[model samples]
Target: MPSPAFTDIQLPAPVLKGRGAIGASDNRYELLSRVALDDGWSQEEQPPPRTEVSFDTSKSIIVQQTALDLPFRQSLNIYRGCEHGCAYCFARPTHAYWGLAPGLDFETKLIAKPDAPRLLTEALRKKSYKVAPLAIGTNTDPYQPIERSLGLMRQVLEVLRDFQHPVGITTKAALITRDLDILAPMAAQNLVRVAISVTTLDRDLARLLEPRAPTPARRIEAIRQLSDAGVPVAVFASPMIPGLNDHELEAILEAAAQAGARTASAILIRLPMEVAPLMEAWLREHRPQRAERVLSLIRQCREGQLYKAKPGERFRGTGPVADMIGQRLRLARTRYGLAAPAWELDCTRFAPPPTLGDQFTLFS
Candidate 1:
């Protein structure tokens, strides 16, 4: 009898550190796959354990902006990387600049902007500063799970309220509902609006795709609560994947409408740089069976490429599948009475608080 052949055992992927980890200023980002060596066989491997959280404070709190196409001319990010860990997140590539993987590391390694409120206040006091609807969560989410304890978002909102600044917030965290006290009064002045990103209503799919986010039902409930509080709330069926969650477009809109969302928006999936491989790995891990089909459909929508970065076509892709999604989204919007009305935040109400110097001048 032939000697029993032993299969090579594979080692798990090693956790990266320093330049290898995300947000590392170093140029080298690395990954090591483990494999077992066996005669006439390859090593077997196991998935690495989940990444852990680490943080650093940013020097400046308010990030200035000159971009024109985006809705907000200026924005703030309370945190870098997000704990919510939505696999299809477009912001993931930003981690590469920090030398981190857009994969697990992007979600696990987070940085908080504790001084955001003060920075915003100072920025607003500048003579060159013009009042516009400042957007929060423009890059990474401001209300990610960590915010509950950090209270950074709450503090930023308090600053916005104090200055009577016009603002817009986009988030998936249901915790935004906790600030109903501030949001409601701001809404009364048309100074604030909220957009909730709802990708799917299927609980299991959402669990696998979003992982750490609030459940789909809870997101809808948050929409309802925001609307009930008279806050102008919208549901964004954003980052719609071609073969994955795209089919739920109409259902998501209808559900959101029922939950009292007056506006609906969508963005085609974006797989910029490292986000492609990360998302592909996610699909293989959590959606292995449908992974191939899903990837193929994405390529079809992206004009045979993994992504299209063209300014006009970036948010909405091209091709037959993209056309279908557009039609479905338009129909849903019309059928559910959702409208793309302007948020039109009030800049007129913006009034800087009295500075000590200003008070002295006034008294003198």
Candidate 2:
């Protein structure tokens, strides 16, 4: 046997329809690099990759967080990669852990946790398990397109409902409205809150940034529906890209408030790891005129770099641009009645679900 020869392959990078990334880039841990190059041969363009779903057999579903700056102490992600395909997703680098590219592969190749409900039930039943607000859609959107057919998120919600556990969900999908049967009741008990992220009000721009997510109008409609159903809804105008969508901040908050968002929040764009390159490529392809200005403004906030990992500065960034963005958000929040504190999901009402054997005790 001979050792295999490893060579980098330069393939074509095309702007596929309904996809956020220009092409798939090799993961950071790969021993070989893959790049796109034109071979000068005339050939028909290949169709874009179709989304593929795979299963994860992990034993646990709940993840404990030690990050003090995060709003939640615990979280669960039902999917590994997001189909929403937002170009600036902060979680893109996580796909590299599975030896997958953080670019197109992150959106096309998806992983589902089929056993999440079962594992969550077991964890919640443990005596050592302390009741806290469990966050869903923290890393990946739990209600991505695949969720419509998989129903994994709905099943997990069932488990949470059975235990009367508190939960917070953040998503850019309107598919969540499909679970109003579960959410409305939970909201009545002060056990659930939903935050919908609307990145841009311009339909065309939103299509480019988050190709697969629901339209901004649909998200506002989702907020209205949730609020009409009595579920407390919050609006997230997140990852505000300076010199680009930042101007829409006030408009977004005002729209959400008109639609019934009780609270609002925002995060400056974060370009960590492979995301920076992907975003730069996307900008060059889509907004070539303003690409340089956008990147320069981002550097202004990140202290002359694409990104800085400082604890307090990561979310809001620094410098005058970031400060002004924050100031504008505060003003919008106050003006639109979105300055209220986040809803306090009731954790004191958590009750352990009765086991099969315990059900038999009723007859005894």
Candidate 3:
């Protein structure tokens, strides 16, 4: 059993607790320390510390191909690390590649690709480049809070509009509604679709687990707005942790079905690498009473491990508990009148935006 007070843990409390990860350690070493409140300490005497976010402009924006067997062929990550620090996010360990702590740093220290639009246009304009529905916001939420000011997602949409290319978006933020001007027309042309992830409908629980994400109501509204706009919309009740939000599986699907969502999907929670310790800490702090049971259920799905690395098996685990969850999802979808039929965007309509030299060709 992995406990929060495990001796090998190192990261600081402020950096990890309630923030996706629990501590920071590099390939080199991890800092281990004991954090205890003094006998004289009082709630009146002090308050919690805040972790400010910082961003960086990354050089590369799109990954040409994915090693994973996802539905899509290519994936673009507009941002590295996420502001909506969901405690069970599988992407947290990716921060370790940059020599940063996967816990707090994975959520607070973010990296954005401001150059994505230009690079995407460049890639699309290539005569040899093939067209496929490019998946956006796969690694991090492209419409996160910072996007209000950055407007990078809107810019990316503009580029896709210029080329009349196909795209599929996934997000938890209601902010996608702000881009209907671009998405609506694209939808009419069969050039765009969206999937909104609703983790749990409980407002209080969402606040504790997903500190910076939009409220569940807001995300549900996003599905409504998108579906109303002629855009194909789907719901993802993802990272369904046991003893936590798993009980709401049917309700989430039913609500999405009522909200005009065309289809629904789900995945079991994954706590790979640094994410395990971090999520364990979150359990201990937020739901200590059910912490052990939660971990036990997770283990039941994960083959008695924190998580398994196998490809297809990892998304939906094996064993009776996992099987029951899968069966329940199918039954709920059927009961709610949900069907995940293919919503393929037209690829034949693609055309490269004319270049400066093409202006002269027009006169000729």
* Candidate that scores best on TM-score: 2
> Tens digits of per-residue lDDT for model 2 on 167-266?
9999999999999999999999999999999999999999999999999999999999999999999999998999999999999999999999999999
Error of 3 at 76 (Å): 0.7
lDDT of 1 by residue, 208-240 (tens): 778778889999999999999999999989889
> Which candidate achieves the best lDDT against the true structure?
2
Q: What is the C-alpha RMSD of each candidate to the true structure, in Å?
A: 4.8, 4.5, 4.6
The CA lDDT of each predicted structure is 0.80, 0.94, 0.83
Worst 10 residues of 1 by lDDT: 18-27
RMSD of 3: 4.6
Sorted by lDDT, highest first, which candidate order results? 2, 3, 1
TM-score of 1: 0.86
1-364, model 3: which lDDT tens digit per residue?
6445443443345544445444443322345533443343243523433544555566555577755758898878788888788888888888878766677777777777778888888888778889888899888899988788889899999999999999999999999999999999999999999999999999999988998899999999999999898888989999789889999999999999999998889999988887888888888878989999999998999889989978888889888888999999999988887766768889999998778767445454
Supply the TM-score for candidate 3. 0.88
Alpha carbon lDDT at 264, candidate 3: 89
Q: How many backbone clashes does every candidate have?
A: 16, 0, 1
